[model samples]
Every structure is written in structure tokens, then in C-alpha cells.
Target: MTNVKLLLSAHRRFNDLLSALALSADIQPFLAKVIAAVEEFLPDSKVTILILNQETNTLHSGAKNNLPDFYNEAIEGVEIGASIGSCGAAAYLNKTVIVENINSHPNWHSLLPLTQKANLHSCWAVPICNSSNDVIGTFAIYHHQPKTPTAVEHEIVNVAALITSVAIEKRELEEKLRFNASHDELTGLFNRAYLNNVGDSFISLCIRNNLNCSILFLDLNKFKRVNDVFGHKRGDKLLCQIANIIQQQTRSSDIAVRFGGDEFIIIMENSNDLDGEKVARRIHQLILESVSNEILALDFGVSIGVAMLNNKPQSLSQLISRADQAMYIAKRSNLGIYCKP
Candidate 1:
């Protein structure tokens, strides 16, 4: 009956972790809940979840409990090797691994120098993986004195790994979904949806505060000829190149979004007519310089239109329409220049 209740409690704890993860956009909240759940479910257990830093070959603390500062710092990470420790060996071997008695295990021998400070007796680690089964991190429990986990203890660790694995997978999926929603896949620039959602908020805030707001509408000149002549592949490459230049020229606070096919927009904060016109002109000059002549037998330039707020427009659509009209006028005069709206 006691074991049955423990299983029920473990099930409830896992659901709690998932619920917390779903509510918070950041990973920290989920980690905190996970640590709490582990404490509740596994009494007197020392737990640590170490996540791999692929770039640095180091491990980061996802969670930790009841470990001294010296031990925490000492055994945080080791190079992936068979003799490095249970974790290093598990990661290196790419499987669930253990060092039952740190004193005598071949794998724990090299890690002894570090583990001696913490005096870890027995440790077991299980690789946490996503739905795709790619290793993301590890779930570990350590004993202060030499002992192997009971069947029930190992089951609890397994449950923790399952919960963590699913959380990691869901978070990654959410990030990818967000990226797709807000950015252009081909040119890797902000998308129209992002402009409508986030860009409008900036404009609204500036208007409420009686501050400056500006928007630039730009169109690529003769972009169709390039797509027709050099093929869409080279036309796509040129667009990416142009987008990169625009990103570099725009201030960090400014928002740049690809409005749609062959067109882009920028929302500049605290920019008056003069400031707005200058940014538009700069982007125009940059495009002219970047593709000065035909590359792969194609020529390209851009027409820019600037709309600055002495007072913010009644709506985003109103500002965008004014800029669009200005772009049409600039397109008529010069292929690459900015016109005030």
C-alpha cells in the first residue's frame, strides 16, 4: 500500500512539473519545480541534473541539492571519457552508466582526485533524451555511503528522466515554432507577422508617450528581371545579401521586417523626419554600393520611402499607406533613393 501511494505521488509530481513548464516561457521555472518534485518524491536523495554545453564540453547545473560548495565546484564536469566518472563515462559511452563503488570502479579511478573532495560513495546516472531520443542532459542521484539504488529508487530516477526529456522536447518545439512565426525562412529576416504583432506595440507605446516613431517602406528595383534572367536561386541569394546589409545598418532598437515579396519595412524609435529620412537614405545607398554592377548578369537597387511621426499616426495601416505612396513616388524618379512621405 505504501509503494502504491508512492507511485501515485510520483505520477502527480511529474504532472506538476509539466504544468509548470507549460505555463512559463523560460526554462528556469520548470527546473525549480523539478528540483522540488524530486525532493518530495525521493527523500534524503542528493540530486543533480547536469546539462551538456556542446560548445564548451562542460556541464551546467540544471538542479542541485545538499552538496557542499567545494563538491559542487569540484565534480561539476569532466572531459567525456571511460575513466572520467559515471557521468563522463555515461556521456562518453552514450548510455546509462554507473560507478557502484567509487573506490574500486575502473571508470571512477580518474575522477577520484576530484570526487575525493566531495567524497561521493556511489553514483548512478541516466541519460535524458527528447522524443527524438537525442541525449539532452542527464539525471543523477548520489549516495554519501556506498550503495546501489533499489528497484523503486531506479524507477523514480527513470520517472524524472522521462519528465525532463519531455519538457526539453516541448521547449525546443516552442522555440522553433516562435522562430518560424516571426522570421522569414529564406532570407532569415523578421517576417510580416512580427511587424504586425511586435512592431505595432512599439508604435503604440511611442504615440501614448508623445515620442517619435518612423517607418520606412522599401521595394527592390527590377527584382523580377533577376528572378527571370538569372533564375530564382540567384535572385534568392541577392535578397539574402540585401537583407544582411539592412540588418547591419539598422540600430538594435529598430525593428526590420520583410513585409512580403520584394518589400521590407523598418520601425525606428524616437526618429523624426530628419532622422527617419537619413536611415532610409543610408539603406538606399548601402544597396546601391553592395550590388554596384551585375553579379551573375543581374543588376539590383532599391527605392525607399520614409514616414516620420511629428505625432504618431492614428493606426499602423495609416502610416504604412503613406510610406507606400512615397515609395511609389521614389520608384518613379530614381531606382535607388529615399523620398519623404
Candidate 2:
């Protein structure tokens, strides 16, 4: 293709990718579309995108259109580091890596046998970066014969990397927004709003399935003293610690919420009154154990009330009300935990 024609083609692909971004709700399929665009530019080469998992500091295949399954599997979960491979090095260095001869390049020496088996002789990779300039992934092209990237190929690599970065950033932003909407800012637990939204649905599902749903209401004792004695910042730290303890006691199926200041609620699925009480006591003990020595010195503790769904079905609000009443009784009597009658 002529240089002018290549430039025009890149422009069209860029527009198409933007349109896809607007319509695409998922990352994988959109990445596939990106690979397709790159394939159009170099039909004989195989294209792959490897995404970095921040927690593991490893690269996983995000999309690969023309690569063999075994080849893809071999590179799965490749750690990002210097001289690792084309994609790994590109991601680690936050720059492009071009290995014109896979067999002879030091980076490719260890994987030479695998590359030969896969019929991949050359690789050129560009790091995909987010708005903050953090490298999030690598966009790479592989050829069957050793060949250096031409000027036009370089342009194609740059465009593909830019497009992929935009897509990744967009997806991450959507996820963060969704998380913030449902979670409490202070404790990172579900907020009362999220419980309100999903509560009725959960109750209905339990009723339909003949499952017992339980609610545990927890109120912190002497929390205000902590805020007054230390500061609001100290109080927030204590609350976060308490929240983490509660999360540890509950299973993934349970919905734990920060109902408001110093008050938490847990909705337990398939739990009876006995089971709810057990979890509440466990949480109370753990919270006491996990609190800082300074916070414990202030007599900070938790009072819990356990309520279970009976034969007469009740809404989530009613269940929580019963648990709340029980919690007050526990607080008044120094019981630490009380089950609703």
C-alpha cells in the first residue's frame, strides 16, 4: 500500500475503533475488533494483545485472532520483566520492542523452540498505556518470517496501541463508577442504598426457593467517644478495621452493609437464626481482637442482634427492624449478642 493510502486506512480504522468503543460494553470482543483492524493492515501477520494483571504483575492474553491455541496457552500468565519476551519487555519497559529475528534475539532465545513450533519468526510490540501513562498491556504483531517493521508498520503499531489504551481506560472507569455507586466511601462496604436496591429481590428469591434468610444488625458501642477523644480520622480508621473484620466473618453470598455511622447490617442467605447468631458472635469477637490497642482502651465493642425469616415471610425492611430491636436489647442488657423472639 502507498504511504498516503496507508495513512488513510489508519484514519478509517481509528474512526471504526472509536465507534466500536461507544457501542461495546465488553473489553474482549472490542479487542478482537482491534486485532481485526490490524489484520487488515497486515493480513499475513498474527496479532495478539496481552493485558497486565496489576495484582499479579503478569501478562495474560487478552485477545489473539490468528495465533494457535497451544501458542497462546504457552504465553499465558507470562510475568512482566526485562528480556522476558517481546510483549513482556514492552510492558515492563513501557516502550516498543521489535525483535526482527526471534531465533537470534536474546529475549527470544529461551522461547525459540516454542516460537519455531508456532511458526512465529518475528515480533514487534508496543505498550498500551492509560491516560496516566501507566503501561497496561502490549499490542504485538507476529510474522512467519524474520522481518523488521517498515515505517508504515510502525504507524500501524502506534495506532493500535493508542486505540487499545482508550478502550482499557474506558472499561476501568465504568467499573470504578459502578463500584463507588454501590459501596460506602469510608468502610468500603455496601452502602444502605445498595441494600435498598437489592434487598427485596433477594428476599423474593429466598422465598421462592424455600431458603431461610437472616439479618444481623450491629451497632458499635462507645464509637462517638473515639471520635471525640481522638478525631474523626481515627474514628474512620476504626470503622474500616471493623468493616474488614465483618467481611472476614461473612461468606461471599452474604451482603454486608454500612447502614450508617457506627451501624452495620449483614444479610445472610440460607442461614437460620442459630447460624446468624453464630456469625454475629464470631464477628463481635474478631472485631474486639482486631481493634487497635488505643481503640480498645476506649471500651470500643459491638452489640449485635440476629433475626431469621420464619414461615411467615417478611420483607427485608421488617427483618432488619426486628434485628435492630434485638440489637438495642443486647446493648441495654450488655449481652453483646441477642436473637429476636
**Top lDDT model:** 2
Q: Per-residue lDDT tens digits of candidate 2, residues 1-341?
A: 78779878887978887897888888888888888878888868899988899999899887756898999999999999989989999999999999999989999999988999999999999999999999899999999999898888898889888988899899999998999999998888999999999988988888889998889999999999999999999889889988998888888889999998999999997644478888888898888878888877888778999988888879999999999999999999999999997
Our tally of clashes for model 2 stands at 0
Candidate 1, after superposition: displacement of residue 329 in Å?
A: 2.9
For residue 177, model 1's alpha carbon misses the true position, in angstroms, by 3.2
TM-score, predicted candidate 1 vs. hidden true structure: 0.77
Q: Model 2: residues >4 Å from true position, as ranges?
A: 270-272
Query: What is the Cα-based lDDT of residue 263 in candidate 1?
Result: 95
How much lDDT does candidate 1 score?
0.77
* Steric clash pairs (candidate 2): none
Return the top candidate by TM-score. 2
Q: What TM-score, computed on C-alpha atoms, does each candidate reach?
A: 0.77, 0.94
